[model samples]
Target: MDQLAAMATFVRAVDAGSLSAAARAIPSSLTSVSRQISALELHFGTRLLLRTTRQLALTEDGRIFYERARSVLGEMKEIEEALAGNRREPSGRLRVSAPALMGRLLIAPLLGDFLRTFPSLSVDLLLVDRNVDLIEEDVHLALRVGRVADSQLVMRKLGEVQMIHCASPDYLARRGEPQTPSDLAQHDCLVFSDAPGVATWRFGRDAGSGQRVRISGRLWVNSLDALATAADSGTGIVRVPSWQVERQLAEGRLRRLLREHEPAPAPLHALYQPSRLGSAKIRAFVDFLVERWRGSDPLGR
Candidate 1:
């Protein structure tokens, strides 16, 4: 048995909560994953997972083994990466995750340049609006927006994203533009429901001194693209990151409203697990993105 492979499979199953999910992620069959786990259990003469009809739970021994296995696997990866470094070229799959809109508008364009620089490197960009478990998913890096919560992940601030309240010109022409926060109450709003605290929009002079306003909208959508499309179709006013609607504002498709009452800038960060920071692939990718986005107009600042 390939002990390292089995260990990886076991860890993945624990993280994914099922052998089936782990198998799908590794692009293997569920039976194969189960067999790998079973093989590992047999080798140790102990059961690690408490199998059930509904859910898989870790036994007490399994929890201890899981933590130790992760450390061992991480060290092995580190050793292999270190040995590979003598070749003096970045070579590996870089798994990255970012918000959908930013992924589309910003990161996608820069990927070509990145790949060209490191010919041996390949990237798997997972664009989704929700946060991902970096360790469980084996992601090398993540591009995150908004105030980062306290966590074990190491983070570097690339810049801040300025948000603006905007509407299509046609809609503004018909309903009139809002001059202040109070005026938003009278207008139909397009809310990005996926964002945290969607029902209450907050703005302030700085992070601390702020006003929170309860808002209701004619339309609420989860995707940024959907919200942008709604605003373009003149459905209602929408609040979006300034970078996203800059072209629309310039092209006369959209107009910025309530300019005086802007929300606090949401900080954009590149986050990675600390354990992987020394790996050549992770380090190179994070540096590449940070160098590309720093002091630039990714957020129209």
Candidate 2:
């Protein structure tokens, strides 16, 4: 048996979850795929798969080998691409994740141009507000808006996202505007329900000293867009990323509040696993984003 070919076949079978699925993926007969896996197991002197009529499970050793096989196969592909002088032409499905609001407002709009630039490539963009594990989720890249707390992942700073507190003109007219961060206690502040005390807004200097205000409100919603909408409709003061409230602020629907005490701007970054650097697709996509946001003041600062 060709050992490397068998290893590649085994990795494909593991990813496909079934011999039949693997055969279909490779456009080969089921017998051929099964034979490859059998040869691979025989070569290793261990059963890699616990096969049943309805399911396939990995044995303990199979799991370890599978991980190594994947890494090896990926490196081999990268080496081949580099040797073939195809490193500049990235081709494959690229999976990217980003915060919901930022993805919808900014990244989503750029997908068209990016795809047009690289017709050989495809993108799967996941937009979610919560943090995602890049390795576990199999994401090639992620756009994060806050501090990157993970030490395991590699990060490249793309831009800064400044947070802002805003209220609708009508609401400010009725309830009066807050003159200080300390005065937020007396006003209705919309916040996320998931974040118990998100209404407790913080403001500080770049030097690290900051003050936190415990705020409460009549509207407690989970969606940032919803909070911005409620604020635009005169519900209450809503603190959010500046980009989210840019249109409202420009249209005079919402007014920026407490500019003298806004918190330090959070950094935006493109995060990925170190292993992803081997993929030309990931490198190209990240480079495109970095160029787009670099000096554009993405935070609307």
**Which residues of candidate 2, in runs, are more than 4 Å off?**
1-7, 14-48, 52-87, 193-199, 294-296
lDDT of 1: 0.84
Give per-residue CA lDDT, model 1, range 1-301, as digits (tens). 9999999999999998888889899989989999999999999999999987556899998988898788678657765785676467778778899999899899899999999999999999999987887766667789898877858988988788898888988998899988778788889888887544438877766767777778888888888788888999999989889898888889999988877778778888888777665678777777787788766756787
How many steric overlaps does candidate 1 have? 0
lDDT of each: 0.84, 0.82
lDDT tens string, model 2, 134-224? Answer: 7556677898877788978878878888888999989999999999998888888898667564456679756367988777777888789
TM-score of candidate 2 versus the correct structure, residues matched by position: 0.82
Colliding residue pairs in candidate 2: none
